[model samples]
Target: MRILVFGGNSLLARAFTASAPSGAEVRIAGHAEIDAPELLDGVDVVVNFARHPDDMRLPYDPARDVDRRLAKRVSPLTARYVMLSSRKAYAASAQWDATEDSALCGQDVYGANKVASEAAIRRLLPADRLTVLRIGNVIGPERIPGRRSFMGFMLNTLADTGEIVFDMSPFVSRDFVTVEHVAAQLGRIVELGLTGTYNLSSGTGIMCGELALAVIRGHGKGQLRIIDPRHADAFRLDVSRLVRETGLRQTADEIISYCYNLGRALG
Candidate 1:
């Protein structure tokens, strides 16, 4: 299978290409430097992971443009398209376990843009040919401090300050997932020829504080303290459908250990 990957500079892109089996052909194009749809000339699938930081300035919405181009323009040329979406696209309403059956929503600009992209892409590529991976929080080694990258930053902050600031919300919860697992599962999805939306998550809910505590433990540190609340309305994703689809499951401890191990490996 040939894959034209946009935003190939990302660690995930590098990891996917490295781990991808020999039969698959993966080509990458910079999100900002897309041209002629030349990258997808004879590609089977286009996997988009491009998103704006919101702080950055650009012409038109980046998410919409990529989605529209790939779904409308690229999909017509390719055999199929697989879009990387977010759990945020789900309605704020809490379900026992979030599934593809859950409602679609746009809570904020970030999510709203992603929602728009998903819609446009879906319009171009139906659920049968197009696949949407509504991924949960992706954890990895390059946990840059003070950035939005969830697991790494928090863990680094905890290790440095001993008491990291927090916005405690009983309602807020996240499904922790590892980059390794996500890439592996997604690879399996394509290899297995499955279609439709699937929630790729750790399949467990943990608040910011719990994640912090896990990070501390992963670092072999003692229990930590929480500071305050930044925002309300817990953000959680239903991943039952993903488990059913992939027959894959991830535990919070596994993710915690992965990050900690990454930190150790790096240093």
Candidate 2:
């Protein structure tokens, strides 16, 4: 199979390329390089991992509308198109485990962009030709310190001062999936031609305090300071569709352990 991946420099894109099938021909391209539509010729699948939610300077509507148009252009060129979305696209509610059918009432600009992008893809491509993966918190080794992600912040702070600080309560829980697991499942989804939306997550939640402790233990020494003790709501994704379709299992302990070790190694 011939596969083209946009966002060659992204963590998730790198992992996916590494985990792709041995015999598959994969080409990596950055956003600038992908401006040439000829690159998609004879490509069996196109996977887009390029949207940036961390850029505060970029306005929401412009970014989202651009992505929508890009999706429309790419949908007709390939046999299969996969878009990486975020779990943040779901509506804020007391619900713990959200499924694919949940309301997409994202209020944040980043989340709203994802919703708009998903809607655009669905509108442009046939159901069978498009696959949307609503991913959760992806944990992996990152080279740069003080990046925008939670793991990035924790790792950078720990490495710099041998301490980690949390302004919020540690009891807050969130779903986290390893980059390796995400890569493996993405390969399966592409190879098997699975379409529609699926939640890619650990299918379980982990407390912030527990995750911090694990990181400290993995690093062999670090202090965790919590400014506020008030607990926050726990949120997890219902990944039944992923398991039923791909037979992939995610364990929280293992994922967290891998991330902690990766952070320590990077540090």
Q: Which candidate's TM-score is highest?
A: 2
TM-score of each: 0.84, 0.92
- In candidate 1, the residue pairs with backbone N, CA or C atoms under 3 Å apart (3 or more residues apart, or in different chains) clash, namely 98-238, 166-228, 167-228, 167-229, 167-230, 168-229, 171-234, 172-234
CA deviation > 4 Å runs, candidate 1: 55-64, 159-163, 169-172, 220-223, 229-236, 262-267
lDDT of 2 at 86: 80
* Residues 53-123, model 2: lDDT tens digits: 45233435645454465566676665688888888788878237999999896635667677877887788
> How accurate locally, in lDDT, is each candidate?
0.68, 0.80
Question: Which 10-residue span in candidate 1 carries the lowest summed lDDT?
Answer: 55-64
Candidate 2 segments whose C-alpha is farther than 4 A from its true place: 52-59, 62-66, 230-233
lDDT of 1 by residue, 1-267 (tens): 887777787767767766665699888887666656366677777777666555133333734366677677665564677788877777677333667777776545555666777777777776777888887778777556566566556656666765445656533676778788888887777776678878787778766666565555556654544455455655556667766767888886676566557545433
Number of the predicted model whose lDDT against the real structure is largest: 2
